[model samples]
Target: MTGGTPGPPWSWVWGAPGPPRATRRRGGGRGERPAGHSRPTPPASGPAHPPPLYQAAGRWGTPRAAVRVGLLCRFAPPQLPAWPTAMATVVAQRLSHLLPSWRQAHQEPQPSGQPEPVFTVDRTQVPPLFWKPYVYAGYRPLHQTWRFYFRTLFQQHNEAVNVWTHLLAALALLLRLAIFVRSVDFWGDPHALPLFLIVLASFTYLSLSALAHLLQAKSEFWHYNFFFLDYVGVAVYQFGSALAHFYYAIEPAWHAQVQTVFLPLAAFLAWLSCTGSCYNKYIQKPGLLGRTCQEVPSALAYALDISPVVHRILVSPDPTTDDPALLYHKCQVVFFLLAAAFFSAFVPERWFPGSCHIFGQGHQVFHVFLVLCTLAQLEAVALDFEARRPIYEPLHTRWPHNFSGLFLLTVGSSVLTAFLLSQLVRRKLDQKTQ
Candidate 1:
């Protein structure tokens, strides 16, 4: 009213104290018109601006900021002055630019159905001595679950090479056996006893070694059992090697002495290896060498067992003078030593972490050298068998094709011994843990 507001009088308005309710007119409804009264017509166009309460106070004449704020804050408490609506509009425009950027910075739009990447962990997650470089995740023990280990066969990790190398070696040994059977009357020979045993032992070692490599990392328990089997394979192979060496070199009189000492000693060591593996794995002693230390005694035993054979070769009237074969035998020994060094030292990977993880790690190198060593030993054995060509004197044994009975006896006894020792160690460890 102070600013001379322009509108129809309030008395004629609908909700004010105006006309009586029964006399109110309805637009276009049937009704009687009073004398000299004309019907009102609607406006052709709407009002140019909104009502004063809703309009910007400044109407964009100068800076409309004050007007916009006043409009925006008109309903604020009487104690507070209203802010300019133009200022609010300017602030809103500025915020509009920042909102998109803020969203992009903090909330990226990912694909609808994409899966999260698989996570890999660190070496601290695995067993202490068994920790391998380049292996990131999935280091569960064997008893936990089958999926984890089975997945490891397909996944890229440190043990990949170790497992595959021995597996390929097993296949190669099988091929070599097939070729050897084709070339010689392996079953018909009187001296086939030792050769057959050597082949069987060699095959067993390769196969077991491969299997252990594949499955040993599953858990400490699995590690102990498979490593025990591997140790037994080593002992059997070593025994067969010494037997063949002595069979060709030692006389019939000394045979009893060789068998008495070497066979019993080999069996004992094999048993020791089994229990040692169990102790190291279940006990988890910091300094104990569960799988690797077993090889030391075997190495010493092999050296002692072969001493007589070496002496016989040196003193023989017509020693093997074949140059290539001799060189191969020497190479075989050197490679075996190299394999032992790699197994003990964990080379290449040890010296340069992550460098040879996928392909040339120490364990894989050891497997390769083992295959070469076996090939060289086979060559040397064949040459020695040829050099000492005895008359065809068949033995009174039943297994004419192979030493099947002996093979079964040796492997079965070794497995049973290892199992008993493992069970004993497991029970003790469980008690301690409890």
Candidate 2:
């Protein structure tokens, strides 16, 4: 080709006419280039003219346009370099790995078909009926099933200690009764009957208290009902204590002064304690008035029930004798007083609200002290019964029907009171919902 004349546009194509083949001129034949001619420089590395499609794509301005060019380049001739197709394949593989995580990050989570976990909440999160004074946190949600409340007996919560203390106490009382029965003729001897009643009452109250604390979170209706029954148990215990004290612990002189009216008054006072407690809870009364209404009758009943023992203690001989019965009586009195103080004062819990939520509350302390008191009281009464058995067995010829009858009547009346009060509470709740 001459410089003055243009070569064909297809000159850049491989195998097209161009310079003489070097292999053909092995022996210097006609295949050799003319002496004046120089082999035309091979066209600069790539095709001399790119396809019009690439030219139209220009500088590949945007990422989307670049992707389109790459897709188009994928179908081009094998001689054309396919850098865009390789880049697109690499990008698609990277996106395949990332797409799931990106979708997961943006999508809402789905439920797993299991119940949501129950957690303890603050006082404000619970219903008003579940609230306690100075207790700010660790209230379980209300309206949970009975199984949930039973399960919570092992869980950490404000009521866990309360339920456990009374439950253990009830078991302890049962063990004590079993041991005591081995020594005394509980069924045959009238003198042992009063102590038997006391043991029975102790077991009743402790078991009822444990059940009350464990299951009361079911609802407002159940809360009132369980605690009302708890009050009845307390009343039964008080009357039982009174019977034991009057029969065994009372001095001759003190018994002479109060014998005519003592049992009757004690029975009345026991029923009164139950009535006051049930009424206080039924009204849902708050503050000092409610506290007084609940506390006063119980205090009076305790004062009456314990009077005979106090008289005997004060009038008895010297303390240096190391009398086991007297020592147990003293411990009983001390523990009862401590229990009363904790019950009324709400001590450490009042000082530090949420800090003692799962443990160490005043009510829990009261339960411990009360259990101790009952244990001491039982030991003292059992000793008193053995010591006075000979004296009482000969003097009292008749079966002491009066003592047992009054206790039974008191228990029946308290149960009736609690039942009536629970019905009233249900009616009030119904009215409120309406």
Candidate 3:
């Protein structure tokens, strides 16, 4: 009743102000309550008071304490403004239109699994282009995708063993080369050039053989191309073997005997071996004739390449000298002969045919034996290099030029031969299609 707002009439009795009375709106509209019930009035406006539990300031009775004790009701959610809600609705509608295309662009395509079935073909089912003489089963289907053929590397196909034998051999050779490099001064010593070339060639042939076996099932064109390159690898390895034997293992008297014509002849024979291999493949000759075409020149090349090793082993001052290098060389020769027998004779496979399809094939045996032969040859050559270092170091300064020149010549010619043969294969393929 004073100038300022008056207290409620019941304030003295209650010891606090009573709730404010609800007011009616100006218009007699929907703001009116029911006849017997009156709604509580809201505050005129400042900040809102917190809930009952949060009204206290002391820690023990606070809202946080209530929450920690699991006695608090749910918290009031934060209010989002209307403008942002409207904007979000608008953005959602806009983005909804793009959802399909966005999903397509961002989503990974599910694999179709078209070539999942990597079953092998029998000889009769095999395509003519992929035929082997005695290999009757386990031939992978022809004209598959490159990925499909590569996947067969893990699968059990005929060429699986062929692929892995050479692949593992390449890895083994690489590891050996790493160990061998530590012992020899490969870069500084000019005489180490032959050793380097031989190692490089070993890697080349092993890798190419693996790749050829792994990927040749792709198509006829790829088949010819890969095997042609494989022949080139063989040729390069042959020349490398010749260089190593000639430079490190030859007797002084034997070196004088073949020094003039040996390298040139070896180079020519390497090219010839590649030529024979490519031609044999190109002709698609079957049975023993086809194999003979492939193996004869390679045999001749091996004979020539190993002659120095043979002579050194035979003419060692004492047959029973326990010379480790000489022993390794003999082991190398033995492995090579066994490899040749398996390669040419087609042993158990020829005898049993399809029974040996995935496992006991001559080609796989040949690959393993050849790798052994190469390993033995490497050990022997390494020992010879160390033993003859003093004798050859003076002669090495002149030797590098000859060795590198011959190596380059051999590589260039082998590549040229492979290229020429591949072109011929392509031409023949074209002719057949026409």
Candidate 4:
């Protein structure tokens, strides 16, 4: 009893081992098992090593490099034949190191609610040769979302494209509209009524488009109605402006100038009626909606996961409506396309002859301007600099835009240069004041 002394407290017992068992730790000796009986590892004192990810054959960059290594490992001419197990162990060691780094890094807590560190993969990189889908497995819905978006040409996407396309178009038109409202257009044209009407229509369309985009995002009923209205407005302007082209008509005593406004406008309305009634169902569930359209989720991993606060700011809505007016800008686009078409199709003046028939006079200048506008529209579509969604990405997507800009600059400069040359040759002297 004296030798034994006092026993352990109440928690301890005479016969049993301790409550918390000791993990089996590896002893530093020959034929030792790894600690905790978890995973195995090569002798720790062997040498420094790269992570498993760094050693992956293909991971070293380029399939050829990996192929070269694998070929050497398996079929080398010399006596460098290593057992598969040994090779696998070495490779596994490297990957094991790499796995811990990123996993641990992401485990680091941040104010943002995300659990893992977002991979800031550059979007412009060689479009993930394979295995990209796994990257954004969490945001799979975004795949369907963007799919619904791009399929608009085939079917309506709750005003996704209609609202946004037109909104973007409006911004472009506003650029042109501003130019017109400024001295360049107002000073030169004595007949400002047409210009004013045209500009007003543009502004109205922009407002409608933006409203449609926002409201439609809220519900399907709103989406359908807003989309319908948007289509109507589009057709109206298309036909109205076409008729307005010949608006430089002699007013009759009885009617207000017999400008065949009804004809073109009616054509547009008829198109809407026919389209809405005939392809209503088809347009709603367009065949292309879930078709070949794919996002390759890894494509914009960085951009899509950007901070929400910055996103809110850049897409700032109008203070009046609390929306940044991304939707409103679309109306401007509708106006521009319709107006530009009208001008190109009808105007037959000395300064800006638009029609094909009005050949001899200064019609060439208008033709050139129309071409420039078309090119600008195409450029905007390709570049989408204003949208700038990439700013929110974990990584940047500026390269595609850089390429797009170069293409636009080249195309526009060439078109402008050609038109100017033609203008210089065809200057009807004082025909400019016409």
Off by over 4 Å in 3: 1-115, 287-292, 319-322, 394-401
Q: How far is candidate 1 from the true structure (C-alpha RMSD, Å)?
A: 15.0
Q: List, residue by residue over 239-287, the lDDT tens digit for candidate 2.
A: 9999888888877788768777888999999999999999999887778
Candidate with maximal TM-score: 2
Q: Score candidate 2 by TM-score against the native.
A: 0.72
lDDT string for model 4 (286-345, tens) is 234312111111112112211121233345555235333323233334434454444333
TM-scores for every predicted model: 0.60, 0.72, 0.71, 0.27
Model 2 misplacement above 4 A: 1-112, 394-401
Winner on TM-score (2 vs 3): 2
Clashes within 3 Å, all models in order: 11, 0, 0, 23
Model 4 segments beyond 4 Å from truth? 1-167, 185-190, 200-218, 239-243, 248-434
Best by lDDT: 2
lDDT of 4 at 29: 20
lDDT of 1 by residue, 1-434 (tens): 11122232222231223222223332123343343343332123312333353344445443234334433444445413223555688999999999999987787465579553232335566666466654334343435345556566666666666677777777877787787788768768767667767777788888787777667766666777787788677767766766566555454444545544555555455445544554555556545465455555656666755655555545455445543345555667788889989877877766676566466677788888988988887777676566545511221223222334444555677678678767976676588579
- Of the candidates numbered 2 and 4, which has the greater TM-score value? 2
Name the weakest run of 10 consecutive residues (lDDT summed) in model 1. Answer: 1-10
